[model samples]
Structures are given as structure tokens and as C-alpha cells.
Target: MATTNTTTPRPGGRSARVQAAVHQAASDLMALRGRAALTVPLIAARAGVTPSTIYRRWGELSDLLADVAVERMRPDSEPADTGSVAGDLIAWAEQYRDEMSSEVGVGMMLDVLSSRNGVSVEGRLPVPCQCAAFTASQIRTIVERGVERGEPVPVIDTVMDTVVSPIIFRSLFGSAPITSAHTQTLVAACMKTARLLAPVEL
Candidate 1:
């Protein structure tokens, strides 16, 4: 007996084209006119799609903005290689703090949080979120590098919980300034955890 194939075909043709065009248009407009000036009609006009097209796909402006924010936050390159795990963590943490604490970063963070962000056509949530996934990928790189050099390193979740989460929480709530010193403090705590968790040789 022959089995039936149940795979969903990848999104393409007109749907893919429209999505690409709209994403590009939204990004360009956000850069040129800022987020406050954006509207579904303006983006549709720029993308050569009807406002209904966007509404049909994304449901609302906040969801559209969240999708765009996820795209914009995708990492273009690997985290900086600063030799030791501690150095790498320090560098990555400081950079992450600076970016996420900026006016634009804060806005993007809010956009991602304000909606479902990127839900697949199958209705699945992005789980860890695309932005958080990107951050985790960077941390994985740092951890792998440390392991390669025989240095003890905390797991990815340790870094995320210790360093990334605090920065995000503080940035979003404005509980404290995300200064370099604050980032360093977080990194130091992460490294301390790693040291304590390291296995003792027989």
C-alpha cells in the first residue's frame, strides 16, 4: 500500500513575494519615518499591497510590527571572540545591554512583547521567540568556544537567566539603568556560577 504524503508545502509564489515586499517596505519605512509614523495604509502603499492584505495576514498592526521586529533582531554575525569565556561573556553582555537598552531596542522589545510575535501558519508560537533564539545561539557559540579551550563554562540557560534576562527585565521595567557596570556584574555572577559548577578532577 502507498502512504500519503502530509507535508505542508513551503509558503511561496504570491504569498512569499507579498511577505518579502511588505517586510522590506515596513523596515525601510521604520528607518526613514520612525515607528510612530507607521500605519497599515502607508506600509501597504510602499509594498504595493492593499491594506487588507496585511490585515488578512497579520490580523493587526501590533502583530505586524512584532513580526518585523523579530526579523530585524536576527543576528548578522557571530558573537565577538575575545579569547577566554569570561572575556567573551563580558563583551557579549555589554553589547547586548547597550543594544537592548537603547531607544530603538526598547521599542523593538516592546513590539515583540506586545503581540504574538511570529506565529507560524500552523498556529505554533515561536516558543523561545526569534530574538531570544538569536541570543541563545550567540551564547552557545561562546560556550562551545570555552569548552574547546578546556575552560569550564555555564550552560546556555545559565547565561540567559543570569545575564540576558536581567538586562531585559531591567530595560523593560526601567528598574535600573543597563550600564556597562551592571552588565559586567551580571557576567561576573554567571562566571561565578560556572566556576562553582565545574567538575572536580579525581
Candidate 2:
């Protein structure tokens, strides 16, 4: 007896596929030309879809761009829990450096965040917000773990603002390149600081 593999596309599958294609095209365009150069017609052409299709789905070029930026800046994988805070933080920092150094990742983030000097066309910087949330979540997890182990919950905000933010800002501003060495240094510094701040259990 032969068994047939029967799987049908869900009702929203086509629209989802189209949305993903549109996002991909927008990301590529942003990487190549920046957000200011993106347009609905260009994205449609790149995605091999109609402008009407894009407009119908996203309503506006800015909306499409925002979604694409969010998708690109969002973490593709969760940070690993290596049972050592320093190791985990170094891994995360490396990932962050890799993402911020990419044309697509950095371009999309700056575009979405700096639109109109903090006034994005979408009325919110979804890309930056998502990225920050992910980072914060990871930091929170590490801090909680350290606290549970009778280690100090270091001031995460300061470390993020000082070390991590600089890498992202420099990369986005084209002021400097974020090399692996820089990331390693930042991670090491943060870890040392955390160790210094480690709380003693009573």
C-alpha cells in the first residue's frame, strides 16, 4: 500500500508568503540604498509583485519599511545559556556585533530610528524597540540567574548604555567599524564590572 502525503496551504499562507517577500525585498533595498531610497513601486518590482498588492497589504511604504526593519533587526535565534554569565554575555555581544555590522541590519535600524529625528512615519520606532526588548530580556535573564546564584545583579542599564549602545551607535553612524576585538573588549569589561558589583549573600 502506498500512502499519499496530503498537505494544503492554509488560507493565509499566500498572503504570508507575499508579506515575507515584500519584507525581504524591502530589506535588500534598504541595505543597498538606505531607507530614504525605498518606495512602494521599487519594493513591488523587487518582490515581483504589484504595487497594489503591497499597498493593499501594508497600506504605505513607511509601514512596509517599518515591518521589514523590525524583521531584520529581530534576533534570529535566542542567546545561549552557557551556565556562565561571562560566557553567555560574550556570546550575546558577539551576536550583537555581527548584526550591527551588517549593511542590512545597521541600515534598517538607523532608518527606522532616525526617521524625522525620532518621529518615524509609522509613529513609532518598532525596530529599535524590538531590538532593545530582546537585549533587555537577555540581560534580565542573566541578572536573575546571577542573583539566584548569590552573585550581584549588576546595573544592566549602565552597561548597555555605555558598552553595547556605543557599538550600535558607531556602526550606524559610520563613525567606526565594530570589530570582533571591540566586542570582546566590551564583553570583558561588562563581565568584570559585574563581578565587581556582585552582591554578597547575608
> Candidate 1 has what TM-score?
0.82
Residue runs of model 2 more than 4 Å from their true location after superposition: 1-18, 28-38, 45-50, 56-62, 114-128, 192-202
Give the per-residue lDDT digits (tens) of candidate 1, residues 1-202: 0001122243599998998899999989999999999999999999999999999999889999987776667666677888999999998788788788888788888888777546556676567766777788788778878877888788789888989888888889976657898789889888886742323320
Q: Which candidate tops TM-score?
A: 1
Per-prediction backbone clash count: 0, 1
lDDT of 2 by residue, 1-202 (tens): 0001112232368888898888788868876987678789998999999999988866777666756665555544556777777776777777777766777666666656654433557687545465576566566666666666666445678557756787778787756677888878877777666643443321
Runs in model 1 deviating more than 4 A are 1-14, 116-126, 195-202
Pairs of colliding residues, candidate 2: 152-199
- TM-scores for every candidate against the unseen true structure: 0.82, 0.67
Local lDDT at 106 for model 1:
86
- Cand. 2 Cα-lDDT: 0.66
